[model samples]
Target: MGDIIRVRGLEKRYGEVRALDGLDLTVPEGTVLGLLGPNGAGKTTAVRVITTLLRPDAGTAEVAGIDVLADPMEVRRRIGLSGQYAAVDEHLTGRENLEMVGRLYGFPRARARARAGELLERFDLADAGDRPSKTYSGGMRRRLDLAGALVAAPPVLVLDEPTTGLDPRSRIQMWEVIRELVSGGTSLLLTTQYLEEADRLADEIVVIDAGRAIARGTADQLKRQTGGERVQLVLADVADRDRTRVLLGEVCRSDVRDGETERELAAPAEGAATLMEVLRRLEEEGIAVLDIGLRRPTLDDVFLTLTGHGAEAPGTARTEEPAR
Candidate 1:
């Protein structure tokens, strides 16, 4: 499949504040590309530019062979977008909101009505189809908005934090919905702050910071790039902390990490072999273990490594550029 969304040298600025500075991205057909960043790293700005909702101050974006700047209408026709907030109409019934989207996209009245029903069913909003969207839960309303985006059955989909503010159950439901859509061969560009979400749904991930692309690769590749493995042990008795630490360091041939918690001791574990060796030695030394496991580097590690901040850290809004 070809690149359905292509962006190069994209730039957007609000006076002295740069929302996007020489940003570049690409999403191939039938794949989900996760866009991750700190609160103001231009992920939302990039989505707007690709969806033709915001004009870029520089560079080019092409969606499904249509240049977003020169022919945004054509690009819009080939793509669907669900933004950070649910854009459903409060006064409108869930069905009506989707039907309106279909009508706006030029579907015939009968087809629009039918498409609305199909989307409501597909998104698991069928039971609430006749109710005013204002009466729906946050997840229901988000599903309605996503259904509205799909009313025209566009080949490419762009979602910006679609699961934000959703409860765990709702987030999982949304993930199932997204998987179903992608299974049908729709290419997707997803911008999300949830590291686990990206880990589950993305075929590739792009991490941006300070308005520039900082890292791009598959989840595992990025994890490997971040560094190696670590083993965490919960000691039944914290008295042996020093012994455990020294044993782990000797086994893994490196220093151990500390201070997160008193009972939990963490150390670098090069691989399963090192972990096994540590376990054997700890047993010999009469160390009590509550729990132990070797874990590879996670996306959170990658984010902190590349951006110098964790994604869940409190973020100051980028006030210079209002989110469009």
Candidate 2:
């Protein structure tokens, strides 16, 4: 497939901070690309540059074959954007909000109304379409915002953490909506803090850290880069903590012990053969084996290995309030 979005050597600076440093990206047409990273890792900055909301200090970006820096209007016409929070008029009804977007995009009054009706039904908000946006829940507002962005029916969609503050059910609903959009051949650039969301939606994943592209690949590929599977064991008795640790060390190459509660092992080879060897060693040493399995590394493991930090690391807020 052809590239829908291409960025090269992009650089952005905010005072003394280098928000983006020589970043490069290419998103193929008709696929969802997830931009994954921690806060201050340049994910938002990259989005702003690509969407033409902010200019880069250096380098170039192209959206749907149009230069984002030179032809921002053309780029805008080809793309739809849903920022972190729902950018909808609270006073307007959901239908009115979508109609307003269509009007702003230069549609006639009748055409705007027709388009609004179509979007309302598509987003499953036809019943709530007449209600003020303020009366809707977080999920409803988010769907409205997304519908507004699609008023122009742009080919490319940029969703910046669209499900950030939604409840589980709401989030799932939004995810389904996104799936439907992408299945209909709309190219998407999704920036998200939720690993599960990316794993479920993104065709490709890009992990950025400290303003640079540290990793990019499919979810399984990135997970495999973490080296090997994780082996977790639970001790039957708290008193067997130290003894078990020592005995397990003979089979486990690298191990982490937290009292008698849990012991984690990182095995170089993750297979049934290795698992059997470990079990035999434990049993031979008169150690009671509680449970064991070869579990694949999660995206969290990839994040920690690449950035030296996990998703829940202190001072690492995933989503920030939009700039007022």
Candidate 3:
């Protein structure tokens, strides 16, 4: 399928900071493109540029064949955007919020009402449709905001960190909603710092750092670049850390690295054979581990290898321009 969203050499600067530097990305029709990056990595900047919320210093962006810079109004009409925060009015009921969006898009009153009702049902918000959004939970508000974006039923959907602050269950619910949209042929561009989110949702992944596209591929392709399985260890005692590292270094293909906790460590392994060897060696030394497993290289490994740092939290990077 042809690309429904295309960006070439897109650049945006904030004084001395370059939010987007010669970045290029595309989303195939009816496919999901996950713009994976740490906070302040220009993911949001690129989204703003593509969605026509902000002008780029230099570059070309198109949505549904319309030039973003040349005819932004036309471009806007063909795409829907759900930004980082739920952009719903607390005073309005969920149904009213969606209907307002429909009216803004120039739908007549009858059609707007009908569309709002349809979306409330689609997003599983019909039960809370008439409640003031301030009374809804965080997830409910988010679903309502996304429903508002779909009021026009645009062909392309842009979600900027859609599940950033959601609880696990809420995030999964949002994923289901997104999956259903894609199944019905909606093209998606999803920006997120969550590795699992990208691995689970994206058809293609783009890894960006400091406003540049560093890597682009499917999740498996990117994982392959890191190579081999990772043998993860959770030591029974923190005192065994050094000894565990020494043991891991002997059998692992690469140096053992500290995990999230002091008791945890990970190293690259050849495969199941390597895992078995490590197990035997550890057992022989009488070293104990709370957990041990061999798993394929994850997107986190790919990010660490490519960027030399883990994904930053949302809002840690100063990538946006001040209000104009």
Candidate 4:
């Protein structure tokens, strides 16, 4: 897919906080690009800049062949944004909320009503269409907000943590909705703290930190960067913990990771040779195994290796800014 969004040398600062520091990113047509990062990593700032909601102090952003800086109004016409908080009117009914957005997008009276009905059904809000939004559940409100963003059917969609506070089921529902959107050819730029969300949704992911692009690739490609295979073994008995750790540590170039309960451990192995060595040593040590396998690296490992931090828990609000 050809890139529909392009940014280069993007720089933005809030006083001493360099929200975006020489960052660059791209999103191809008909693909989802997950912007993954931790607290104060500037994902939100980048979204604001690309959507023309905030102007950057320096650098360039181009969307759908229109320069974001030079033709912000045109850029607005080509993109839609759904933010972390659901932007909806609690006083209005679900149908009314959608209609209001349609009217604002310049749809005529009759057409606006029709679009509202379509979207209500599309987002599974048809039954609650006439009820006040204040009575809507969290998931309902979020879906309504997303439906509002789609009122004008802009080509590119940018969602900033759309599932931030949702329950697991609600989050899955939102993911389904997003998948359907992208499958219909709407290119997406999703900013998220949920690595799993990014892993499942993004065709490619870019890990940002301290306003810089630290890593970018498919999930597997990034995971491979952390190291080779991982030899994970869970002992049947906790008594063999130290012996297992010592033996596994010798075969792996890295330190053995003992689980808190001491029944499991994992180590970075060089390859099959190391795995064979580990198995032989474990056998000699008479450590009974519940399970053993050589597994590929995960995104979590990638994050820890890259930034000295793991992915933040879901629903975390990242407001602390890195010192400039």
Candidate 5:
């Protein structure tokens, strides 16, 4: 596939804060590229630069063969963007919101209405099309927001945290919709905090940290780069935690204890073989293991290993809340 979006040496700064610093990215035609990062990692900044909402301090970006800096209007015409929040007008009906966006895109009134109806039906929003957006659920409003973006039928879509705060079922539904779009040949740049979402939807994954691209690869490739497999051991008794740790220390090079019931170990061998050996050792030691298994390293593991922080780590501003 040809490259539909290309960015190089992008940089952005706000006063003393450097939002983006020498970032680069590429998206092949008809594939989804997942952009993963923490809250302040410049994912949103990248999206803004690509969508022409904000100009970069340095570097260049191209969308659909048009240079974003040289011809931002042309890039805008060929791209759609859905940001973190649904941008629907609360007073407008769902259909009205989409039709309004279509008109803003320069579709004729008739064409806009037709397009709106088509998208409403396609997105399963037809039944709610006549209701005001304020009456819609979070999922419905999000679907409608996405429908608005597609009204222009752009070749490239930039979705920023499209599934944030959605219920599990709604997130799954949105994922299916994204798959359908990609299947029909739309190039997508999706910025998300959800590792599982990236693992499921992204053809390639880019991990960003502190305004820089730290890693990029397919999900499996990233996992492999993290090295080895994960072994989860759940002890039969909380009292055995210390003894279990000592026993695991023989074969496990790294371990994390979660409360009293669970401990995670990282082994340098393939998970299954290492798990079997560990189980044997436990049995010989009369450890009475309750559960044990081998599993592939998750995207979370990669994030933690790379940043010395978990993906779910709260932003600095929000870290002062008392734990419930």
Candidate 6:
């Protein structure tokens, strides 16, 4: 499949702040691209530019083979966008909000109403379809906003932090919906601070820092960069710590490191084979472990190692601001 969304040398500046500096990325048709970054990393800015919400200072963006700058209206017609915050009319019923979006896209009144009903059902808002969105919970509002973005069933969908404030159950529901969309051949560009969300939904990931593409790969490929996998254990007795360390040191790829708690220790391992080796040694030595597990590096590890901070770290927000 070809790229449905392509950007090159995209630059956007908020006065002295380069919100997107030489940023580049692509989303293959029928695939999801997760855009990850810490605060002030230009993720939202890049979304705004591609969605035609904001003009970039320089460079190019295209959606579905149409230049975003040269044919923005056509691009808009081919892509659906859900921004950081829920963009719903508080006074309007859930059905009305989606119907309004369809109407704005030029769907006839009857067709708009039908489309809205379909989306309400698909997003699990059918029962509350007639209630004003202001009465909805945070998760409901987010679902409503996402439903609105799909009223026209555009080929390319851009979701910016779609489940940012959702409860765990609600977040999982959204992931299911996104996965369904991709399965039906919809291309997606998702920007998120939730590592697990990206790990679950994105076919590939792009990590941006200070407005540039710093890392790009599949979840496992990225995780491998932060030291692959590790064998971790908690000793039943603190006295076994030194021996456990020595035993692990003999088989581990790297030196053992203290885990989060006093009795816990972790060491890099090749994979399941190393885990088995550690277990066999512990059994022979009579050292008991309260817990033992082998785990691959997570996106959190990749984020910290690459960006020098967590994904949700507090700092300058890179959201849109009045040019000063």
Q: Which candidate number maximizes TM-score?
A: 3
Clashing pairs in 4: none
- Once model 3 is optimally superposed onto the true structure by TM-score, how far is the C-alpha of residue 269 displaced, in angstroms? 5.5
- Each model's lDDT comes to 0.84, 0.81, 0.86, 0.84, 0.82, 0.86
lDDT of 5 by residue, 1-324 (tens): 679999998999999888888998999998999998878789999999999988999999999889998999899899998867438899999999999999999999999999999999999999999999999998888889889889999999999999989999999999998889888988999998877789889999999876778899997788777664667677767677777777666666555434222443334445577678778888887887666777565555676666655556622333222111
Runs in model 4 deviating more than 4 A are 227-242, 246-264, 268-300, 310-324
- Scored by lDDT, the top model is 3
Q: Summarize candidate 4's per-residue lDDT along 138-186 as a digit string, tens digits.
A: 8999899999889899999999888888999999999999998899989
What TM-score goes with each of the models?
0.84, 0.82, 0.85, 0.81, 0.84, 0.83
Compare candidates 1 and 6 on lDDT and give the better one.
6
**In model 1, which range of ten residues has the least summed lDDT?**
315-324
Tens-digit per-residue lDDT, 1-324, candidate 1? 689889999999999989999998999888999997768878899998998889999999999888999998999898888967438899999999998999999999999999999988988889999999999998988888888888888999999998888999999999999988898989999998766788789999998876888899987777666655778788888899988888887887766776346878676677788778888998999998988998765645666566655555523332222111
Candidate 2, residue 165: Cα displacement in angstroms equals 1.5
The residue pairs found clashing in candidate 3 are none
What stretches of model 1 exceed 4 Å from their correct place?
233-242, 250-255, 258-265, 268-299, 312-324
Candidate 3's TM-score reads: 0.85
Residue 50 error, candidate 3, Å: 0.7
Residue 100's lDDT in candidate 1: 91
Q: What is the lDDT of candidate 5?
A: 0.82
* True-vs-predicted CA distance for residue 112, candidate 4, Å: 1.1
lDDT of 6 by residue, 1-324 (tens): 799999999998888988998999999998999998766889999999899888899989999999998999999899898867439999999999999999999999999999999999988999999999999998888889989889889999999998888899888888898898789988899998766678899999998887999899987777767666789899999999999989999988577877767799888888899999999999999999999999766655565567544456524343432110
- lDDT for model 6, on a 0 to 1 scale? 0.86
Error of 6 at 261 (Å): 9.2
Model 4 clashes, total count: 0
